[model samples]
Target: MATRYTADEIVERLRSEIKDRRPLFMPNCGMGLSGKLQEKGGSDLICVSPTSWWRLRGQGSLAAFLPFSDINELVFEMAREITATVDEVPLISLSGPHNPLLGHREHLKRLWEAGISGINPFISKIYDESFCEQISNIDMGWENEVEIVKVANEMNMFSFAYAFNPEEAEILTEAGADVIASHCGATRGGLKGAKTGLSLEEAAELSQEIFDAAKKVNEDVILFAHGGPIEGPKEVEYIFQHTNAHGFTGGSAAERIPIEESIYNVTKEYKNVPME
Candidate 1:
């Protein structure tokens, strides 16, 4: 059976865990990746989305290329898959403002009823509509993004903001984001032109800024870092030591990049092995 947690209860649990210094290692995942991560002791949070789900299931090329309307069913299907495949770890839906379904409160309520524990309404600031043709039509303004977060909070879903800078971070917190993630652009091996946003050094410097801004509004909000310079446990530890963020969150880094390398290496080596 699926476990239900209110936004406040989820935040309280996350806060207590962070207070104990048990840093969160949330990785974006779907069915296949969730199963692998779960077998390896699991993540503190698992981010579920159409993109990652499709990618992990061998339809990755279609993930970024598909539109929100086209992929919404896949997203919901993946959510049900996670409910069956993963246990304990909070499943946060990584949605966007362009999402046709999540733009309304009733749909958000339906999502919660379907067993999703949280929502991460990620708004891409740098890309224009033309630029995002490969991704979805994520043309939501800051106010639109904030309103989504507000509705998610109103629904009592654990709301997370995927902010790339301190300013966005501040706005999201004020708009009622329970968790604010400094989501730098994707790193090497992710989508084309993925290496954008703050450098690791710059992100470390901005962490305090994000933390201060968030704390000013919601003192109990959780801060996390994603993508860019952060990869693996060492980088995660470095971010924790250098920044005010409590944990690290990964998507391609935790799912695609490593999987690509491992699968490629293993398959290549098998070619060298005797097939006869």
Candidate 2:
């Protein structure tokens, strides 16, 4: 089982990494084996989410955004497998706060008890303006997501938030999020990844804008870049060069793409071997 970490401990660990001038690498994992391998590969942190579960099932991460299943419940189920395999690296679970059946506080407590050290809002900040407005009209909106971060902060649990623009970043920072990841959109490059979104330059500009907004609220809050054009080492390096982002958060770029390429290549290599 993984060693549970206090929120402060997790923050200190990340701060120490930043102090060393090392870029934090947080990868989202969907399975026990993937989490174990990521830990062994020196991941700064491992994140589990319903999107990750879908990705591992050969579906796009967006599948989690659909109403086919309860995302909060999926996080718990994935955490069970991940916590059982990841022994040291801290785990962050991405969850939706709009589950009417599960109270946010109760859900957070359940995550803490399951050995997760932190929480991030998933299926929250990724929608379009019209969809967001509609969700807000129904009382299931961005504020609900912010409330989850607020609750996590008050509980002394690490709170990481994803923001698409400056306004959202400011709100989450004010809610006491320990880390603000500037989301560009769905990641691009993998088989199931987004084919069109922000360019590298656009992503960097947006990241800087969001980071600035978050810093205005709490300068101490750590910052990261995620999704869209920020897919791999080269793009990450570009982000680091162009903006003040402290690290990166990878969903598809971390697990699905690598797994797809590795398995496909190896199978092809085997098939290419000369037969007797």
Candidate 3:
């Protein structure tokens, strides 16, 4: 892909999106959905992680299934793949607690030089419960995330901080995260009996708290909400009305859930066709 905008340019565009009050929907996608999302007028903010990227490329789950010992290698490979696939859209790399950036500054610089627009150091307890437990010996806390944001700021790169509540949002914003995302856990895709986080109303309320905390420090910081029950247009509209969030960072809500429902309905309808 041809290089278009610099990292600072991407950050400026994100700020512009907030100033305009137009909530940009950043759908986490790979080659399959990025083009379609662009055609439909989604935000230039595109997110991709090793787990999701591998799944998108038809490689199944991340390290759970694949034999990968080094996460840094995985991140580089994922960035390369996304770099080759995406054109103009700004790519955001979602790094977990295991990534080298948490410890090594040079690793963070490498991520920026690899054509990545931004970095989201996300360690979702609910989404990665098993992985977290597996790495219980290793310390992966909020301080590391703050350090990642600080490093990104030092490099003039955008940092999308994943925060579960208002307190986390405040700390991340104070740490110079360009975007403070209020996130719950990943929503269960097409599952009838599965656990989820707060309801949409609760998510909006939490977002308002996060907004207040973030505004206490930097009013220009881009705020967004994700996961939990905030999916679809009505939910998104509710969050914007109730909270100060400028948009949402959609993951499974943008990809798996819709595809599951659509494919099932389409296949069921075809299966029930009458024969002559």
lDDT-better candidate, 2 vs 3:
2
Local error of candidate 2 at 219, Å? 1.4
- Which candidate number has the best TM-score? 2
lDDT of 2 by residue, 47-146 (tens): 9878889998989988999888988888888888899999999998988888667788898899989889889877555777799899888878888889
Residue 165 in model 3: lDDT: 74
Off by over 4 Å in 1: 32-36, 57-71, 99-103, 129-140, 190-193, 274-276
| Alpha-carbon TM-score of each model against the true structure | 0.84, 0.97, 0.81
- What local lDDT does model 2 show for residue 160? 85
Q: What is the C-alpha lDDT of each candidate?
A: 0.69, 0.89, 0.68
For model 3, residues 1-276, the per-residue Cα lDDT tens digits are 625455578777777776786677777764535534542565557776655555444343333224463545666666666667667777777765444444636756677678776788856444455765655546554456788788778877778887777787788898898888887665544432135667778878877888788878897787788877876777888888888778788766666556667888999999999997
How many Å off is the CA of 235 in candidate 1? 1.9
lDDT of 3 at 135: 52
Q: What tens-digit string does per-residue lDDT give for candidate 1 at 1-276?
A: 346678888888787788887887677776744644653664667777766766675644335544634444565777776777665667777665655445558657766777777777745454565654544435444556678788877778888787766677778988789888876666444432155566678767766677777787778788888776776677777788888788787776777777777888899998899867
Residue ranges of candidate 3 with Cα displaced over 4 Å: 2-7, 30-40, 54-72, 97-103, 124-139, 192-194, 272-275
- Full-model lDDT, candidate 1: 0.69
For residue 52, model 1's alpha carbon misses the true position, in angstroms, by: 0.8
Candidate 1: RMSD over Cα atoms? 3.8
